[model samples]
Target: MTRLFNEPSQFADELVKGFVAANSQWVRPVAGGVVRRAPTVEGQTAVVVGGGSGHYPAFGGIVGPGLAHGAAMGNLFASPSAQQVHSVAVAAENRGGVLLTFGNYAGDVLNFATAEARLNSEGIVTRTVVVTDDISSAPVGQEHKRRGIAGDLTVFKAAAAAAEAGYSLDEVVRVATEANDRTRSIGVAFSGCTLPGQTEPLFTVPAGRMAVGMGIHGEPGIAETDVPTANELAELLVSSLLAELPPSIATAQDARAAVILNGLGSVKYEELFVVYGRVAELLEAAGITVVEPEVGELVTSFDMAGVSLTLFWLNDELEGFWRAGADTPAYKKGRVGSPSSASTAASTADTQSFAEADRLTLAAETAASLPTELPDSSDASRDAALAIADAIEAIAEVIDEHADELGRIDAVAGDGDHGIGMQRGSRAAATAARSAALNGAGALSALSLAGDAWADRAGGTSGALWGLALQSVGAALGNTTEVTGSAVATGVSDAVSGIQSFGKAVVGDKTMVDAMVPFTERLSREVNAGGDLVTSWRAAAEVATAAAAGTADLLPRMGRARPHAEKSLGTPDAGAHSFALIVVRVGEVLASRHSEFA
Candidate 1:
């Protein structure tokens, strides 16, 4: 377990601070993450890469002369907020356009896509390359649905190299896409990792057994079996990747690949070498020539005792870029020439000034702007805002009370962060709603602000989904005189639709949608029958609770849990349960405040 940490919530921030201090020669701190201390060529495309924290050397550690220009670091196992990504991108941007690259997880996709849109809106050209190289997350036909794992390094390196070599933004994107398509990775874990302050690991493997196709986020593997010998493990990894060679590679005998035997966290370099030795022998036996193979921790999950192998199929152009010189704090290759003196001086000054200015701007923008006194809105609007605040406060308390239970449920088949994420999001949302209410914002505005805070603080798949749901509902609520039963029902319907659209999860996917759809349907029906807000919401909450309980009998069909669907059969989805709890608690608050409407 992670013994070293001041506070669980402050871990990511402190890690970044210490990292920048220790690697001053290579990286400098920005508002959201780290940027290269050494300036890039002016008008050259900048490659920005990032993801959740705990995956060191992957993101921040790779920011330097020949790798990522900047990295938008997030909380542990969570994607950075869109604001964080945008700030880092702005600090990293030069005359050339920017190319954003990261793992293909839901939160990362949502936030990165949001950042890309925002950048383009601001007239800063931007492109994105989502790395999806893990073969275990999806089938061959649904490759787009696969999650990114250790192969993030290969794709990021290729993009960064192309950018460093003065490729256009489009060309850099092309190369990164090709790298992702040609690369394949598979991982195995002896044990799961623990988050800071958490006494237990996310998941556990039985003694004398190992998990195959395990994700880096402490998610249980798809299959578990007796631990194999070093040679056998290596063979399993190689065979799995070789079985799915990219179309560009004509045959195994004729393939040339750049291989990476990556340690997740606690696995030592000696063990990696032992595995790589066997891996190299097998590849040679298959007549594949391995290029400069890397064996060490590149992407990690806290202190997970696991390893993943990545094979990047190579052609002439890819091999050239793969061998290109790189000088980062944690990774370095062949020597790279020094930048021009004039450009270096100018770039240094520009970087310092831009970083400082952006930091101040971000600080100002993020600061709370609560009013000392309520604004002069309608009395009905004020009452509605207060009611919303009360509901959110109730929701927060309920989530906090059951957070541990929810985490336990999630750990059965997923990374066990759902409870913590929901707690964080709900607390942030409650605080934001209270502040907005104090400032005399209408119900719609308050909820919208709350949604933003939830997404910003939570920083995960659930966080993003909740944020979208709340924002969609708030938009449907509007800022009119008073919130009516019809409006509330319409808002709930809109939220359900938004979540389905955003996550692509249907009602039976064993996600929050399972509960949410039932709740929305019931609420709409009750409201259409001329019921009051409290009555309709209470009825909907009951339906949601039953629907959530019913999820115990269904198989998971989405997210990380999909791979371990059978394991999750007897457990309720953490998200669905939490949603049910929140709605029920909020309904109680609504009932208590029914007098306000009267």
Candidate 2:
């Protein structure tokens, strides 16, 4: 368990602050994350890599010469917001376009894609290469769906080296994509990791047992077996990766690979060295020549007792890039030259000004996307806003009550952060809604503010999806008048459509969509039948609750839970349960306050 922390919620921020202070020679703190203190090369593409915090050395420690130019650090086990990514990218870019690279997780994909679009819109050309190297996440046919793990280092290094070598943005992207395709990783855990201030780990392994194919974020492994010796474990990792070679690598005997024997967190260097010993012998026995293999902590979970092995199949170009010199706070290879004169401090002011301008432009674009015509404040609008505020408050309370249960359910096959995320998001949403209402905003404006707050505070896949749902509903409920049953139905329908479009989860995916789809259909039907808001919402909430319960019989097809799909069976999805709970509580609020709005 993590013992050192002022507050669990503020841990990520504090960690970053301390990291920057300690590594002042290599990194400088920025608005969203850290950037290299070294000067940027003119016309060289900036390689920006990032993900959730807790995976130390991975994000911040890798930011320096010949590595990531910047990293957009997010909350622990949560992807950075699009705003965070954009801010870091803008600060790091040097008029030479940008290459964004990160692991292939849902929240990271969504936020990185958003940031890429925003950057391109502002004349800062950007391209993305999502690292998908964890073989256990999906079958070969569905490789695109696999998650990135310890293998992230291979892709990030290649892209950063290519960028530092002055490769064009397109070339940098090409090399990074090739590296991702060629890399493969597998891992095992003896025990799960605990988040700060949490008394329990996300999951637990039976005594004398090891979990195989475990994810770095405390996700349970796909299988469990009696703990093996170091040699046996090394062989297991090597065999698993060798069994599924990339198309470019024909046979183990003819392959040349770059290897990384990475400690997840608590695993000591001596243990990694022992494992690497057998790993090296096995590769040589197979006639494969291992290049400068890295054997230490690279990517990590919070004190997880685990290790992963990454094999990066090498070509001539890739070999050169892999051998390139790099000097970062936590990682260094060979001797690196000093920064060029172009990277002088004089350009710092200019870069800061440019970054600020980009931020203002983004803010303006966001404002323009919302409704331009503001409605006059009236008694009906004020009352509707108040009711919306009340509903949010009720939802927050209900989520707080169920937070522990939801976290437990999520720990079965995930990182066990869902409950905490929902609690944080709901409370933030409620606060924002109440503030908006008190400031004379209507229902639409209040809900919109709440949505923004939820997304900003929650910082996960559920957070982003819920934010979209609320914002879509707010857009449907125009601020010009009081919301009626028909308008409410339209808003709910829009919310469903938005979530589906954004998350790409269908009813059988064992996600919130399982409950949301049924609820929306029922509400639409009841409203079309001339039912009032109270009756239709109550009926829809019942359907949602039942649908959520039904998820226990289904298999997970998305998110961190998918890798351990079997473990999730017979357990209700945390997201689905939370969604059902919130809607049911909100229905009660609407039922009690309907007459005021009417």
Candidate 3:
């Protein structure tokens, strides 16, 4: 049922509509979605910032009186096409020359470098500055490979201030580069985002799990683990960024740094501040000083539920500029502070809800119980399931290689992770499942082993639910040498019943039951209707697919995401999609092996 959009060949056109609407006073679309507006100044050095969209306010919001004059906006999470970059330079250049800056990513490097050349030919001078703050992107030896995160804010502010202070374009670029070199950042994702008008998310984070070092878009993270609490999450992110901070910065007497607590769209501000408070406390304890802490949605991914913390090791020059007066619709510090005084007085009479406190406690407890060690890989069924896990692992590698194109497909429905999570979980499961599979064990036995490994190795509410489902199915078919449609139906029924009992959820819960319940129900109808196993399975698969589709109409009612159930009505549950895929694939496998069964 998923289909691709063909109307807009390029994303820039759609985004420019929004950009011009938002900044008509200060910005105008010049060429190729590039905004030509600059902050008020004359004969002053200029700083230019740009990158793919979806990380909003980065290149665009940073353009103002105390910021860059013009910004070159790229497509969503993709580098601007070379022609687009070239056109932007034409609009941004002046007598003071232009200084270009963006995060350090391969596509960006290639595009910007090309733009630099084209600009020179036009007789406009331009220089480049790259930010490398994500320590996890590269090992210590390959620091250049790391991509910029929140730290880009500091570099932009400093660069802009320098340009406004009458420094030459060369000096501005140098100062900006220095700020980037001294800044670092790290992030974790709880959920993914979707492109505008896309029904499905680009990536997925399994329930009760988090993706550490997640890319600005839905790119893969360093690892997926049990979801951590605000405090714990802050601790981990801060520790990672600090580990990579220049030791001199940490030990210096003036080891002051500014923190930009960035929200990846849809994350509530209250939660962000909670995390920020902890980050501030931790840094203070570690002999680091926190300068003016900026907390808000500065950069975003359509509707992703994640956060990234950026720290800029500041010197007097940077600090002075950071505090210097500047105003933009999104990045203003002065107007924002003034409103709080009046709003706080009006809201004080209202009672604060303690609901977040309860949720926070539960999340912390859940994180603590996650499985870190893999279960024994000695069982045959476990091994086969692990093979499926291996299939999932292969998928992640595929995604990493094709990251540039993933958003196009994933933006349609369900988070694109049908490829990523399966790859990660299956890979982990296979490593544990293979020990038993290699012994040439029977199908049912391998599956049972896989169930155990999956439950133990995967660390989300989904993993636990799935592991339980598989274990129930394995138990129903104990000692069976092979699986037939009847056997599969029975296993599926038992698995569904087992999961339902513990989770106390129903078919319309927008969970896996959306697919499983319908498939099992149809399987029973087919067998009673007197069809052979294969025909019965095919019928059941059809039913499962329909039921999964039906979930798009039902809201999630049982889980951490329950509050978002209504919003999810038009999107199928991720678990349901996974189940449907498994059912369809299993049916195909059985059909192909029909002769063996006979």
Better of 1 and 2 by lDDT: 2
Q: Model 1, range 192-287, lDDT digits (tens) per residue?
A: 898876788887888899989888986555688889999999999999988998877789996899999999999999999999999999999999
Measured on C-alpha atoms, candidate 3 has an lDDT of 0.64
In model 2, the runs with Cα more than 4 Å from the true position are 218-223, 251-255, 337-379
lDDT of 3 by residue, 351-444 (tens): 1222233236435543443343334432433433444334334433443344333333233332332333233334444554455445544445
| TM of each candidate vs. truth | 0.90, 0.88, 0.55
lDDT of 3 at 238: 85
- The global C-alpha lDDT for each of the candidates, from Candidate 1 onward, is 0.85, 0.86, 0.64
TM-score, predicted candidate 3 vs. hidden true structure:
0.55
- lDDT ranking, best first: 2, 1, 3
Q: Please report the TM-score between candidate 2 and the true structure.
A: 0.88
Model 2's number of clashes is 0
How many clashes (backbone N, Cα, C below 3 Å) per candidate?
0, 0, 15
